[model samples]
Target: MNSPTAPRRDDRPQDDRTAHRTILLRGGDVHSPADPFATAMVVERGQVAWVGSEGAADAFADGVEEVVDLQGALVTPAFTDAHVHTTSTGLTLTGLDLTGARTREEAIAEVRAHAAAHPADPVLLGHGWDAARWPDDRPPTRAELDGATGGRPLYLSRVDVHSAVVTTALLDLVPGVADRPGYAPDAPLTRDAHHAVRAAAYAAVTPEQRTRAQRAALRHAVSLGIGSVHECAGPEISGEDDFTALLRLAREEPGPRVVGYWAEQVAGARDAEKIRALGAVGAAGDLFVDGALGSHTACLHEPYADRDHTGTAYLDAAAVASHVAACTEAGLQAGFHAIGDAAVTAVVDGVRAAAEKTGLARVRAARHRVEHAEMLTPETIAAFAELGLTASVQPAFDALWGGDDGMYAQRLGTERARTLNPYAALLRTGVPLAFGSDSPVTPLDPWGTVRAAAFHRTPAHRVSVRAGFTAHTRGGWRAVGRDDAGVLVPGAPADYAVWRTDSLVVQAPDDRVARWSTDPRSGTPGLPDLTPGADLPVCLRTVVDGRTVFVRPDE
Candidate 1:
């Protein structure tokens, strides 16, 4: 598939240092997840200096500084979500969204029009709110949010932040949460009483409203072509000054490229210097050994085929072997959030007993990770390929909860809900997958997460579309160690995505080859429209990092 005129080879570095501005791009159709199709790259000052064809643009026409051409469309790369929360998807894009509220009286008329246009108070907070497509499947009480917020103190949330639906003046401001322990005398609020009213409305917002809800969730992940994000952030309910105020407001804004991950819980990983100042800013995020399979509290090794429960293991194996030996002796690269199968065999026996009490080549050179090894068990996917770890998944939660009347066959009934999120049985047991959109609990669309890991609505968990676009580009930059951020060629990182088809590399038998070219008003159904398509028409005219940050509306 390398034809624009094929004859390329520029593998970078030949420096006499001064020929930098190149772009070129030429007659498009490049895919390069290390080739699944398309071809013709080039770039330069941002990296990827020359991929082939279109007669390799006359060998970069004496160091061309701009070419672009692309009369073919469909390039790739620029998509790396790998788990997100980026200031709760930028505070669910400035709150009161109610995602696609089908009912609970249309999510209480969108929280009574955002508590009557923000009537100053400690209570009007709102969030996603899907009482499983309510029609009385129940969830809006607290006397129906105190008769549509008139008594103020409302709360909302519940598109799986594991529950929250407060009111009654936020249950009289959290007093004895109707007898706690994930409260539910007929679900008064919910799960740990809506995780204490969503940790007191995310600790009473402000820090300039959490930097304007994380720059409106990094401008909706750079108008949906993503780039990078792993934020995660929970530390007993977000702190470390909310991930150093979202990495100092994403290093003084110009969005996307976050990678934070410090949701510790499980007794805050026995604070070994706050897990080495959250692995001193570079091993890129993780921590959590259970909870989430829509809060049945994932930690299963049998016992959730219609609940008599057998989950919930948030650390206990000598506190996840002393927080994976204090995050692998402080150089940090540990992750955990295992989605049951006894929390992926208690985090693969706590990272194989913290790599045999420290020293499996210093925990495989600190590349450790697990986060949602969903419900694996081919001996925990061959112990995640004999402990090189890193799974960090979320194939759009198996295309919106792998259907056939979803929610894992009504809560784990169909043979342990046919092991969700296997990603082709963890890449045929060599295990090392990565792709995420846990964003405000899913909807960040890396091409609808590579079409739900390539149409894997359970056909034994599909996977292919060049293994879901190299698990969302270079296995999410080698799960955050970032070897030059996802690929393109020459020297990487000129971050990509051009596609209005070539369909993320010829795997389109359905999802009409990565859909979207229209439809996005948050109807929230398989998002794609970063608008461009009209017969080979993808857009992003200039998302260049050496200069242009998102440009397409005809450039």
Candidate 2:
């Protein structure tokens, strides 16, 4: 027998060896389009080396340094969350969670307890309180919160994050907040007031606190099999220090990749340069064209059913057009947060005008995105296809606020509510779809997100699980102009996850399609059974760029 010896420095550079560690994963289902029957895969050099059956895997078994026996678990591309607020998500994860508090009294009690528990925290912050779902259907008053916190500074954002109710003590922190638009002495702040107050509240977060929060959020994402997240940071949402620190931390650690988007308008080359300097991939994300529907602030052509007037309009067609044109000329992607029909109309009209000025080919090639495009008309959907725009949508919106009796229906009436989040229409019209959690707003449940899209409340809007899965995976990469990643092809980036699932099954929007897809000759691979109430696949391992970023304990 040959004597064992330590690895020699002459063999290969340490960094190169670490980056290109050879591994063979076999005895499992490999969800690769290259081979529907693939039971094994070879990963090397931060990329997928090959995928084939277990019988073929024997050829590479002797050459690899490590072998992971999947033991019938399913392997798939790790999800990419196209929209997220990293710091806020982290804060919410570690702070007071009011999402489960059902009534105004219950919410206040939770806040009181949270404040009591964290007396050292300069400002008491909480999130995910939706009055629409409450039995009382009334948000806790600022005065009530004042009494609950014993006059401490308190800021509690609504579920949508578009509006927030702050105690008078917190209000005092923002100078002249009473003069701001959308401010009410006792009600939740919206528009300019909401923006100002949110900025002030988040500014109180220390750098150490911010870094801890960011690390928590990114670490949580990896545990859920998420390989990448697009951070939607802006002046109104978070400061430059917060955004930059989060990005720096991600780069310095082994975690999910962070694609940053600074939500600011670009008027010229200088503006675009400033955005690029922040390490943002685009001058896009939460560039609010209007507020959210639940807040009754979403820009609408008609008045909201529960409210007396049309919602707030932050930017008109002219402003949107100018921004798009400037971004196109500067070779940067321009996007917006548009949730209402009127807002979607403005985006379509503006992009069309931009296409006219900058040449349709150039505008189309840029692939600008529209976040939370939930209220798109057929005309706007067609325009999205024509303009080559990407719809960065959240299926959880429909899962939570859609349906006959949900918040969307309450705000827009049932007829209009039926039209929200038309994923099938967008797909049929060739508008690209990228799925996300909007995190902190919804959550970082990748499988749940896919299931929500596949089983949308509106049957007309529902898509097949495969389509939803693809959107959550490959579509996010395409949104950022990368056509080569987010899959398990031979040359694609080796970003994938292994799941311990009950069973793998082919699912579709209907029984007929499901039957056809499951046929033996169809050459389709199976996914976890995502039927409503069925257990979601649990992550056993997650790898990004051929590096193991997360491994389930006791596995």
Candidate 3:
């Protein structure tokens, strides 16, 4: 495990012991999330010196020069998103975002608008359009997309990032895509097909534009009180040089800390030497066991209900086993993206065999993780506990896709649907859970993610507010092996969130918990009262690490 790189823009002196500034946060109901709620906290030189009642502030008062009266607002540890595509998220912020398009027509309209605004001569590029929720349920074809932009070579990605819909003009630009075996058969461009278009589009982004996008995304994360993000950009999406540059810039700028993970296409190429090199460079490598559920390619044990095929396995079993073994030998932790039951089982077995071969005690310390264990059987769930694996999940997916009439039932039928997104069940079975926003796929809002996990559509799957909060904070810190982050104890970093609400703990009646409150306008359900007898109105005032990085307008 490695500590996150500091933002490059920090001008403050790094001398922690003899810093002149001392700030006291008084009268806030500090919910460490890792610990029970406390009355106040004191921060000195970017570390927590005291966290208790207001009376404990006197210990640090000798050199204190500033005091923040929270007026009894709620405070919690700063959030750490365990998995996200940082630079991609930043690009989406600065580029065309069609996340809200509900139909082919709407998606086309968005692309047309973007093309009009940017007016690029060669290709029009945009991302974040999901056809899974569209009225037709069919992705817009090349013909339809061509018609939309008048053959402007438009390319748009689905929300899952597993697939993309490109117009004929764009298809013509790719050298051998039309003759690619899986291109037309898969219908929607996914996996290798998506990779080709994404490469072409991403290449169009200049260094200056990419940097601006990264900064914009970083500022947004700061605004949302997210202190750290594990940037999961695979080699296909971003080259090693791009990742190195991004990491260096992040360390040199005033922004969120970054943990980079490389995505490798060939597992055998990931040997001990490669792993050590990545470790020296402060980056991790990830593999894809399968594609995504939206594309019906999440390698399932059984065939999809509506389709004759079981999902595709991106990596063969042998490759997975070898990758795991190599990672273990190289002192590197490997992560696999496994969203379906079949994928989960294969990854689990592969990891187990590798660990057994290498000795479990040795591999356990590496903390290999499984990203998006969205669909798991009881046996696979148990395997996670036995292998000491971590589950990196996105709660917002459940919030948008967990209703009875959702995609799970529509795509997999009723029986298979029962196994979707069992977060609580995984926790019960002793799997270490780390939460993330998976931004560009989902909005990067930690508070909203907590709310989604706490109010899962399936009652049994719902997690307690405290557990959800901890997943985003402490568990995330643990995932990356930064023990001091996501806590308010003395000697820990001074990263923390101040909420307008009293507590994240839900106290609503059981019946009312599932139903949206009478006020449909209320964005969050079961929120604690900010003002007694009134609705909770939580807002981040400042996200501070000894010094404030973001301050709300009112503050």
Candidate 4:
């Protein structure tokens, strides 16, 4: 229960306990994102104690234990990824990665190379193949993968993580799966069938492998200027054991902080107890209302332009309302993964019903959130603002598969697709926005997220660069009910990143550079110009709660 100005405790003398082990970062542009003129910062214990000009360092030097020269590196609050899969993203770091695969044949070739390297793996597990950008606009079929692995059990997930393809041998492991809903003979599995296949595919990994995977993911987050990550865990996405292991690792080991959310459709006391037992922040984080659009499973109001399917719904309005009400009554956050207008409408209806059942004040106090509210109308946005909903969105989704000739345009026609992910409109309507990269699905790049938000495919929906930076930084902390974190103010958590960067603006002036400077309109400072082609900063250090989670070695 530390106050805003209370310093963290230490075993030092009474006079020193209030401010122990202070360190000053000098000669750097301290763009707390809110404070543009601060050229120096003081980190005491695990909190920011002071921020001022570099000349002020000497005033605190007597009590300070260390003074590190920044050499003009940009210092700012570390990033937080709102929605991420812990082990799944980790496995991609060590397993088959097809993000560079340009064609269907190239994707299969990567599988062949991985199979050749690991001839003894029980089941081949990999992800990140997208057919949307391929010339043929098709993914590698089970037959193609079987040829790569010589008929061995294999499961390859799509970039969206909503659909996956499994070889016959792997499909055989889950008996009678072909007869279930969302089953195709030898093509990619979607909906229920895909979940079953994915579970079966991952069973081959032992506990040791799972631990390594989680570690790899955390370390990667640290190197990328990320201090914390919200793990979107579910029974379908990653089982209870995987979630438990991840939380335990963050608690015991030195790495990025992890806030766990169990994505379960809780309807009663029993489910609430389950979430409490798991020590979760909420009962929803990808609690699927529907699947992803790339998989042709999002619960859209209209049928797909290229196909006759209208998409699927895992939870109806009643289910959503019941879950939100129960979670609200039990003093926990409720969230859902909703991607289509139909699903968005259902969620809005459910929120309204929950407000009637449990007082709107109580519902708002819980600070319930929604993931990927990508397709929303004006009414839906208004409901979100009324209910105090936090829209945990990924702007990178649009950068990768949006615009005139993208996957969204192919599935949904150009007119319908053009209206997706209205970030600016959401902000204007007072819906709190938090930006993130749903890593592995999209790479975990905070700068890239900000760039995409500022430069959206739809010009009218673009947010200011300052707004995008705030969403990725302070807004992420607010989404998890921690207004005290993610800023560089005194008494805030000493969670920040030091970066090695070049030009701060897109078109640099010949005489001067625009480092973490401010835009005249809002007065809030912006991060380095993160436009698509500009060079992003390199992380030199990442500190979380005053501990050095990552530091680049002098090479």
Which numbered prediction scores highest in TM-score against the true structure?
2
lDDT per residue for candidate 4 within 178-295, as digits (tens), equals 8889899867899889989999988888899999999999999999899889999989898889999898888777677788899987878888889979868788789999888899
Largest lDDT belongs to which candidate?
2
Write down the lDDT that model 1 would get: 0.65
- Residue 461 of model 1: what lDDT? 76
lDDT (Cα atoms) of all candidates against the true structure: 0.65, 0.89, 0.72, 0.84
Of candidate 2, the 10-residue stretch with the lowest lDDT total is 1-10
**After superposing candidate 4, which stretches have Cα over 4 Å from the reference?**
1-20, 505-523
TM-score of each: 0.34, 0.96, 0.88, 0.93
Model 3 / residue 434 / CA error / Å = 0.4
Order the numbered candidates by lDDT, best leading: 2, 4, 3, 1
lDDT of 3 at 15: 43
- What order do candidates take by TM-score, descending? 2, 4, 3, 1
Residue 463, model 4, lDDT: 81
Question: Candidate 3 has what TM-score?
Answer: 0.88
Residue-by-residue lDDT tens digits, candidate 1, 52-131: 66764686687775777767776666777878777777777777768688878888877877888888856566667665
> Residue 207, candidate 2: how far off, in angstroms?
0.5
**Higher-TM-score candidate among 3 and 4?**
4
